[model samples]
Structures are given as structure tokens and as C-alpha cells.
Target: MPGVADGQGLGPVLTVPNLISFTRLLGVPLFLYLFLATDATGWAIAVLAVGGLSDWVDGFAARRLKQVSRLGELLDPLADRLYILATLIALTVKDVVPWWFTIALLGREAVMVLCLVVLRILGHGPPPVHYVGKTATAILLMGFPMMLLARFSEAARPWALPSGWALLWWGIVLYWVAAVLYFIQAGIHVRAGRAAAAGAS
Candidate 1:
């Protein structure tokens, strides 16, 4: 998720956009239940479609209505991550994608976590969301639904599968590239902080 502007206060917690993000978060478990427990592929896809659409809607609404808040910023990305993780688990369980594919994506997330930790230790919060990272996320979100469609719908299998894989591959590449950029950014900040501290001492 994108960070608030510099000097912007963490606005109120309650807002329309935050509510939309919360709704998207709730759909994550429902998606898992529909896809995994009930075998309702169609409904699961419907839930995913709504989640993806709402992702965009909430962002637009936030900007348009000036309802952006710290909580909304957090909730938006949290919802996206939860949906991606849920879909990955479901896809792995169904044998639609290989275990390594899932792990590779998750591994990128782990790297991000480490980067955040390193930054925090240096008295810095997370850096602003990079455009490349946002693009990767958008691509992955779109790719997963197409992959599910390709897997379950015979009619869509021909085109959806190839296109889905293409998107996923591109998304993964960009995902790792973003991770590397974030890591480098963190290192630079840490080094700069230390240099200043040393000079001060």
C-alpha cells in the first residue's frame, strides 16, 4: 500500500474506503471456504472478482473522497496479501500450480518482512510503496483469477491458462525485482544513518 504524504496525519479510522477494505478482507476466508470446502468454483471466482474490483474502488474512493487514513493504508495491503495467500494455498491444494511457485512468491514476502525489520531497527519506518511493487501486485491479483478460471472452466482453459501463466511469470519477476530494490533502499538508509551518527559522535 502507498504511504500517506509526508507531514500528513494518520486520519480518522472510520471512513468509506476503510470499510470497503475491511469488506475485502472478510472475503478472504469466504473465498477459501467456497473454493476449498464447498467446491463452489463459480462462487469463489465471484468473490475474488469482487475483491479485486473493490481493491481498485477503495483506492479511487479514498483519493476522490479524501478519506485516506493510516488504517486504510494498512488495511488495503493486508487485504490484498490475505487474498493472495488464500488463493495460493487453494491453488496448491488443488494441484493447479506447483509448490515451488507458491514458495517463490512467499519467499519474496519474507524478504520484505526482513527489510522492514532492518529499517525499523534503524529507526526508520517502511519506505513508500514503489510503483513497480504496486504494478506487480495488480498483475498477480488479475493473474490468479484467470488461473482459477482456466483450471475450472473448460471453455476458458485454452486461452486463460496461457495468459494466466504469462501474467504470473511477469508478476513474479517484477515482485522479486521490487524486493531487491526495497532491500537496497533499506541498506542505503541504514548506512546513511550510521555515517551521520558516527560524524555526530
Candidate 2:
């Protein structure tokens, strides 16, 4: 969603909500660093859980604290993407998840981002964050913890492996579906904006 706020006045960046968003931005790299440094399953689960918590915390603070800024809106999704990307990379590196999964996840995100960039250049606004998108993200976040637990838990926890795999696959499917929807919605917005602009002239 590059430059979606170009002409819009999103207000100052010092507000509480924007501060939370900044914190989320910082958290993304930190989470990645933690995962990269530790090979322990326990550490992975802990850091991932905290990363997920940061996702929720920033949004909650933004809305409740009434400090929402355009920068915050922009950075939130970006942070989420970065966090997911890091986990996907880590999971692939550890062999807990297949390489195909990482490729697909990253490919979808790349496509969505390209669409957003194209839309912005075409004079269209950023696509609305659809419900499907939200659900997709939630599923992925939930899947990561389950996957981590599966890796760390002992043989006594028989359900962890299967449940974690199931959740991970389901989340990947949902994310793909959501990515399709995002592109479709972006196309609609672009067309509408173009038509409006043409008619105005």
C-alpha cells in the first residue's frame, strides 16, 4: 500500500496508537532475531507467542487508546508480514515445514504487495482489509504456536504433531484464498478509481 496516504492528512506520529504500532515494528525484527539465535523449540515457541501477542497488543492499544495514525495503519500489516515471513523461514530452515509452504506463503505476500503498489500508482486507494485476510492471519498465527509445541512436546502429547500439521496446512490454504480475494478487491478498487477519474475530467 505504498503512498496510499500521499494526499491524506493522517495526523501526527506522536500519538499513543502510533507508538504502539512503532513497537510492533520493532518487535518484528526482535522476534526474527530470537528465532535465528536459538534452535531450541522452547525458545521458538516463547518468542513466537510473544510476537503474536505484539500483533494483538498494538491493534488493541491503537483502538482503545484512540491514537490511530496513518503510519500505524501502514506499519501494522507490514509488521505482521515480516513476522510471518520470519517464522516461515525458520520453519523451513528447521525442516518442520516443507519448503513449498514457505514459497507459497511468500509468493502470495509478494503478489499482494505488488498489487497494492500497482493500485497506488494507478490512483486507487489501498484495498480494504477483508475479513478473509484477517482470518487467514489468525489461522497462521495460531498454527505457528501449535507447530512449535509439536516440535517441543514429548511423545506423551500425541495430539500435538497431527494437530499442528493440520493447523499449519489449513492456515496455508486460508492464506492462499485470502490472497486471491485481496487481488480481486484491489482490481475492483482500481477500476472504480479509474472510472471516477475519467468521468471527472
Candidate 3:
């Protein structure tokens, strides 16, 4: 918050927070290799935990150490998205979760991409991250590992699947709600930009 002035963007890309973001981005491929190629669920879950911890760590480092950067802002979310995509693919391939669930999540991302493309063509910035969206992401991150844990042992499955399913479903609902807010925000951005253009004209 100290260094982050507005959603417009921030300073140089060379910073600790950006470094952390870079490290997080590196984990995605490694996670996929462990989960999909080697079938190493335990190791994959550990890698995921690191990814989630890094998500928090990088933000804290950015604010507390005043190392926030425009690159970090962009890359942090990108890393999270890739992690989500990788997790879905790995789990689905392992038969831990259904393919349709992955489709639903990816479909939301596809819609967002289309919205962003439209916004860019019209000369408007994409909407800033909303708290609800962040919360949904965090909740889903927590649930995903638990979901894998469900597959770890039959004894754990009874409680783990239910807990994970509960969080996962709730997170999906929250994610869609955030999508609605984003669309509304996109419209607002467009209208504001048009109003500013008309005033200038």
C-alpha cells in the first residue's frame, strides 16, 4: 500500500516482490511435471502449498518492503492463473476430479479474456482485482490441495472430500459473482472513458 499509488501501475520491475513472483511462476511447470508426468501427488501438493504461501509472501514483501512493481502486479495474477490451470489439468488427468469442473473454471477465464480484449480495443484498462475475487481465489487454492488429499487415503477421503467439495463449490459461486462484478466494472470503465472523451471533445 505504501508504494502502490493507484491501479494505473507502479515503479521499476526489479524488486524483491517481483523476484518472489518470478519464483512462483517457476513452480507451475515443476508442479505439472510432478503431478502429471511422475504421478507424485505428495510432492505436487507440497509444491502447491509453496505456491499459495508465495502468493501471500510476495504481496507482503511488496507492501512491507515497499518493493511493489508494475511487473509484479501483472505477473502475480498470471502466476496464480497458471497454477490454477495446472492443478485442474493434473487432477483431472489423475481422475481426482471431473473434467466438467475444469471446463467450468476455464470457461470463466475465457469469458474474462474476451472482456479484456474488448476493453483493450476500446482503449480502456481492464478492471482492477476485486476483494471478492481474491477471496474466491484464496479459498479455491486451499480447497484444491484438500481435494487431492481426498485421493491420498481412503480414511481421509470421508472428511477431506466433503470439506474440499464444500469450499470448492462455494469458491465457484463466489468466482462467478466476482465475474459479474468485473463485467459491471468493465462497463463502468467504458462509460467513464467515453464521458471523458466527450468532455475533452
State the displacement of the C-alpha of residue 149, model 1, in Å, after optimal TM-score superposition: 0.9
Score each candidate by Cα lDDT. 0.83, 0.73, 0.83
RMSD of 3: 3.3
Q: Candidate 1, clashing residue pairs? A: none
Instruction: Give a tens-digit lDDT track for model 2, residues 33-136.
Output: 66667565566577677667666676677777666667777777777787788788877887767888888888888888788788878777787677676667
Misplaced by over 4 Å in model 3 are 1-10
Stronger candidate by lDDT (1 vs 2): 1
Candidate 1 deviant stretches above 4 angstroms: 1-10, 191-201
Model 1 lDDT tens row, 1-201? 343443456666667788798889999999999998897899998998788767678888889888778877788778878887888888899998889999999998888887788788779877666778777877887888889999999999999999999989998999899888877777777888889999999
Candidate 2 local accuracy as lDDT?
0.73
Candidate 1: give its CA RMSD in angstroms. Answer: 3.9
Q: What would the TM-scores of all predictions be?
A: 0.87, 0.83, 0.90
Clashes of each: 0, 0, 0
**Top TM-score: which candidate number?**
3
Give the Å shift of residue 160 in candidate 3. 1.4
Shift of residue 117 alpha carbon in model 3, Å: 0.6
